[model samples]
Target: MTSDREQGTGGDLVATLIRTAGRRADPPADAYRAVLAAAEDTWQRKVGRRRHWRVGVGIAAAFVLLTAGAALLRVVVLPMMAPAEIARVDRVGGGVATRPAGAGAWVPLVAARRPLHAGTRLRTGPDGRVDLRLEGGVSLRLAVMTEVELHAPDLIRLQRGAVYADTGSAGPGGIVVVTPAGIARDLGTQFELRYAGDVLRLRVREGRVSLQRDAGELVAAAGEQLTIDTAGGVTRGNIARDDPDWAWAETIAPVPDFNDQSVAVLLEWVARETGRPVHYADAAAEQRAASVILHGRVGPLAPLEALGVLLSTTDLTYEILPDGTIEVRYQ
Candidate 1:
């Protein structure tokens, strides 16, 4: 009987232990709540991280668009703004304008574009002193009162002036002075041209200049001078000598006639004198001239003096050169 009682006690103890083990294997209610809370916190943190990353990317994209738009606006809108003040010079007596800080006085042989930029000014004196300061350190001094139109980045029109151009460090086509006779292209050097009566004088100081005309072209070198007449004559000389004709005819050729035939004939004649071919790019330029006759051999006083004498004889406009090659054209 005693043995049976012991077995029953053992069985009951084993059953109680099994039930306690099963309850321990399963989590408590409070433990389940704690695990759920941790899961929720972890999910919230992941969502917040994703949202922050998305916001950062959005901001970066927005910044890029803003920058690009600003750049585009600058390029599209800036050119339409009003022009800034480039230069302002006081007009001196006799239509001369002086730069506040420059080497010489400047005069416009022709009506010039106003509000010139820095380094360009007009200077003149009634006693045969006129000049234009082209950009690139070029100063063109005239022996006669003259006028010129200044067009920047490479164009100048000589209305009426005897000019000595000294260019500084400018490239080819950097500056051009257009006269009634033709066009002078500068190549970072010094040169001079005078239109007096039917004569034009050209002198080269440091570099070469291309004097282009419908009838001829002349490439002047440093230290060389030439002259020409409206009657198709030419003369070449040195610059050191006193230019007597320039003094007398400084005020002579006040106007340039673009329609004169004598100028073209003179240019062709000058080409003959220079031993170089004068080719006309425009075929009509050769045929569109009226008859204007000139007399005298091509020499120092040949055509310049003759032009002054025959100024009223024919309706011819003259372009003179220092090498004694003159071109007369119809005005």
Candidate 2:
């Protein structure tokens, strides 16, 4: 029942749609595969980039953590490992300084009676000196412009300058001093070890000292001085117990308790310290010394000065001979 012109237009439109559909016959299977492959490649590229970024971030975080841990170890853990106390500072004079075992800024160490530990480094400035008492009644004395490290109760590293050690009358052989040149082993001795200008000097005030070196072992007896140069050259010299070279040690000698002590006791102490022999004019003089008792403190006077002051208090006089002999006589 449609009009003839409308029917004709509809038929032409249908024919044109059929021709267009035939020309576009469903996309080829190869083209569909290509599109899918392109999409997968694009996804992988984006994911790989993200994965790489994540890995970079992880590495950076790990680096930061390691750096912080190292800092913490140095700042906290290392300092907490306290050194063991093996000695005490009996006397510290002048510009004396102290530092920790391996690394630290030098700081003033002025207070006496301060505890000194192993691994402590001590250095003295001009006019500086120190006196220390180690285990076993050993006396350790440092000289001016000296640097040393307390390795143990019986071991010391003399880097520069001089150190004097007195192992007492019994002289238990447990002390040794080390230097760049050699090791000085204490054979129950009172000795001074000095290192300067690549030279190692050992002067035995009493007993003996031995050096263990790569070349051979050399022994130094009492009243002997051993000099070992950088070239391993050895030289021997004689030293007097009362030599002026030992005057420095005398100045820094620890003061003894003088209160209520006998004159005889005082004389013995003085003779022992001065490296001199003590004699009496007679038996009566000896009896008098033992009988008299001294009272009050002598302060920090040197051994000789205290002897003079203490003798003045009693009816006793003393004389020191050129041969390092002390003669006590009744006044």
Candidate 3:
């Protein structure tokens, strides 16, 4: 059933396709040449007796396979090696700026525009503060005029700024902050680490923190502060959980995802964030707190302010002591 006209048109199309592939495609010169040479050799040996048009088809098929494979790697493999999402800005106060991994000018942080990756440098303006959420429920807050580098998921370098961290009680996650003076690591706790000039301050609001330096390692428990100087001299002091020094951090504490949560959950969060121990006036109060549930957003208010607003809805009364202990009462 084959006709001369059909064979002539098909031959012309195959010849044009082979010539276009060679002229337009820009593949690896050596690889392209090698593949073409092998394909042509095979065509000559096996299809030598066949019509010349079939030879053009075989060569074009070889080029398609090569380019298709290269396209596959470009679409699939390259993306796998790109930087991953490591952190995100949860709260922004005033002016916050960040620089990417490469050397460049620090640009104003676009709130939630994109996820933050490691090696990114961020700093706050004189009146700026920010809260960043890392993987595993770790909260990092940067104070005004602080510069830090997100070195890794669990590590940050406090170049010359103050950073507060709160590792949630529900997880085993913690963060290590490195400074010129020493390295401070949290012990399942909420704490602050600040490096200013020749001094590095490590304050533990709840749980404990440890400092590792060239000389040795020292631990500071709750309500304790350790000042490490450039000369490596460590001085110990006391800082209350609800001290005025922590007011800035309190203002920027990561707001809980408090949707339809129990009153006890909010109470416990306030107590923990303010570094106050929680105590119920009686068994009835504890049970009442657990019974009541909350709805809607808490806004961006500080922990104490949010607690006050939420507690006013319920008949429960609460008291905060001088030592930062919060007592809840049903009456």
Root-mean-square deviation (CA) per prediction: 33.3, 27.7, 20.4
lDDT (0 to 1) per candidate: 0.50, 0.80, 0.80
TM-score of model 2 vs. true structure:
0.73
Query: lDDT: which candidate is best?
Result: 2
Q: Pick the candidate with the highest TM-score.
A: 2
On residues 131-150, what C-alpha lDDT tens digit does candidate 2 reach at each position? 88886678889999999888
- In order of appearance, the predictions have TM-scores of 0.39, 0.73, 0.72
**Cα lDDT, model 2, residue 120:** 91
After superposition, which runs of candidate 3 have C-alpha atoms over 4 Å from their true positions? 1-80, 110-114, 170-173
Off by over 4 Å in 1: 1-125, 128-133, 142-144, 241-331
**lDDT of model 1, residue 136:** 49
TM-score of 3: 0.72
- The CA root-mean-square deviation of candidate 1, after full C-alpha superposition on the true structure, stands at 33.3
Model 3, residue 134: what's the lDDT?
A: 82
| Candidate 3 local lDDT, 40-69, one digit each (tens) | 433543464345435545779786566556
